[model samples]
Target: VNCNCDYGCPCQFNARPTDGTCRAVVAWRIDSGHFGDTRLDGLHAVNIYAWPGAIHEGNGSMQSIIDERASDAQRTALVAILQGEGADPGAVMLQIYRTMCTAAHEPLYEPIHLDIDIAERTARLSIPGLVDSAVEPIRNPVTGAPHRARVDLPFGKEFRLAEVASGRTRATGVIPLELANT
Candidate 1:
């Protein structure tokens, strides 16, 4: 999924996480896949955490976690795809995950929880010990009104618009995501 991290992520600014450095964890479960003749079925999850001095500079480190149930071939294919291989160029999902990463960590196997309700402006992503992130509409302080902000990237491979707001977050392994006063 596409995300808004301050004005410029290290990748965009040729730097690290907007707050001086770069660090984030991205995990996903593939419901289905077919890399050539290889069948990738069942539930699979992977996590990527990284810290870069500047995203464009390309010297950041990263950690990858994959589901233990995957076969050796499946694991290799997923890693390659996540690392920006075999996919179309300019595919933001793969490109962004790859270019900005500098260091690589061993993959882990674990359960990941994910839920999304774009229409309701709510989303949650979490892992037992790795991450827990949530997104919702921003609210007005005095009236408790929900404020909504959208960033449109017409050419971006991700969504064209993203709602920014104040959200509650609790992430330990990666940088904590707290939607605050957007």
Candidate 2:
């Protein structure tokens, strides 16, 4: 995930954004999963979002991009899951995000290239002509030594533990974004 915020996004802590607005591009690569018997392993998806104010204030724009290699059934299942269908209300993060957005653009099918190594704190994601993003370990400003940190949310719906890293993103789709060191 990359956004127009400082290295540690304040939003995660329920704080306002660094700037007064919010814009982010988040991508996920499913290593192993199933959506109603439709295998979602090795598939990738991306979500781009922007808001004039805090997320809870509404009036946001969002778009989804899915891997073009997925089959028809896989595409349908992915779309359904991402759009928050067939899940208990507000149980999934995507569902909550969808409700906060006023504009939800049509999903796009595109070629996606994603490589992630969570243990190494490195990731690279690219979609031809659409988005390019990367994640890397954070470094100390003075010593230039790699800094490691993690956020643990015991009851969080989105995740239980997350490694904090630096991220950069450039997107040129319906919801364009250019984020650095976020």
**All candidates: CA RMSD (Å):** 4.1, 1.2
lDDT of 2 by residue, 1-182 (tens): 88898866787788898998989888989999999899999999988999998888889989889999999999999888877778777888888888889999999999999999877989999999999999999989999988998888898667888888999899998898888888
Per-residue lDDT, model 1, residue 22, is: 45
Index of the highest-lDDT prediction? 2
Q: Each model's C-alpha lDDT? A: 0.57, 0.89
Stretches of candidate 1 above 4 Å error? Answer: 1-4, 7-17, 29-33, 39-46, 68-72, 87-93, 157-159, 165-182
At residue 15, give the lDDT of candidate 2: 89
Name the best candidate (by TM-score): 2
Residue by residue across 17-82, what tens digits does model 1's lDDT show?
555554554556566876777777765564444444445556765555566667888778767766
TM-score of each: 0.69, 0.95
Q: Which parts of model 2 are misplaced by more than 4 Å? A: none
